[model samples]
Target: MREAEEFVDITLLFGEGHVKCHKVIFMILAGRSDYFHRMFLTSMVESALNEVPIEEISASTGVLLVDYLYTGRIKLTTRNAQDLLVASEMLLLGALKQNIEEFLCEQIESSNCISLLNFARM
Candidate 1:
C-alpha cells in the first residue's frame, strides 16, 4: 500500500504556547473511519481523544467530556468533581481552563490540601 499523505503546517498546542511542526501528522493516530475526506477535523479530534489515558482521567471528567463531545458545550459544577481541574488542565479541557494556574497555585500554597496539590502536580 502507498503511504498516507503527511500533513504540513501542523500546529499543536504545547501548554499555553503552540508548537509549529511539519512532521507530526503521523503522530496523530487516526482510527478506522470511512468519512475521513468529509470530516477531517472531527477525525483528528477523535484521534487526539484516543491519545488520552483513562488513568490520567479525573473523577467527573468523563461526564464533562461526554457533554462537550456531544453538544460542543458544558457547564462544570463544583459538585461534579474537584480533582478534575488538574486533568482538565492537562487535557486542555474547557471545564477547568480559566484561572487554573491560580487555583493550582492556591492549592499548592496550603499544605493541608496535600492530596489536591499532589493531584495537580501530575
Candidate 2:
C-alpha cells in the first residue's frame, strides 16, 4: 500500500458535496492527463494551492478518476460507466475513454441502444 502523505500533494473537491481526495500524485496525474498537466504546470490557481474544485462531476466518479491516475485501472459498470466516460473525457485520458467507449459499444442492444447513443453523443 502507498503512504498517503508521502505521495499525496493535492486535493480534489467535488462540487458542494462531501467528497475530497487528498492522495493524488502530481507526476502520475500530470503524466496521464493534459488537463492535469496544465493545471499543475501553469500559473493556474490550482498549481499554487495544490487543490482543484470539480463541480461538474459526481463524488463517486471523481474518486474513480483519481484511482485510475494512481492504479491505471478502474471499475466500470453499467451503473457508472457513463459518468466515468464523461470524467475521462474531461480529464483527457484517451486510453480510458477508449476503453469505456468500447465497453459501452459492447453493451449495446435494442433495449438500450437509444440511451447508449445519447450518452455517446454527449
lDDT of each: 0.42, 0.78
- Candidate 1 weakest ten by summed lDDT: 29-38
- Quote each prediction's TM-score: 0.34, 0.86
Per-residue CA lDDT of model 1 for 1-122, tens digit only, reads 01221343443333333333333332321122122222345545534432322445542565454334334565555443464555555455553455454554554545547766555566
lDDT of 1 at 46: 34
Cα lDDT tens digits, model 2, 2-112, are 334445455688765533344347667788899889988888878777567888888788877877877898988999999888888888999999999999888888999
Consecutive 10-residue window with the lowest summed lDDT within model 2: 15-24
How high a TM-score does candidate 2 get?
0.86
Candidate 2 at residue 11, lDDT? 65
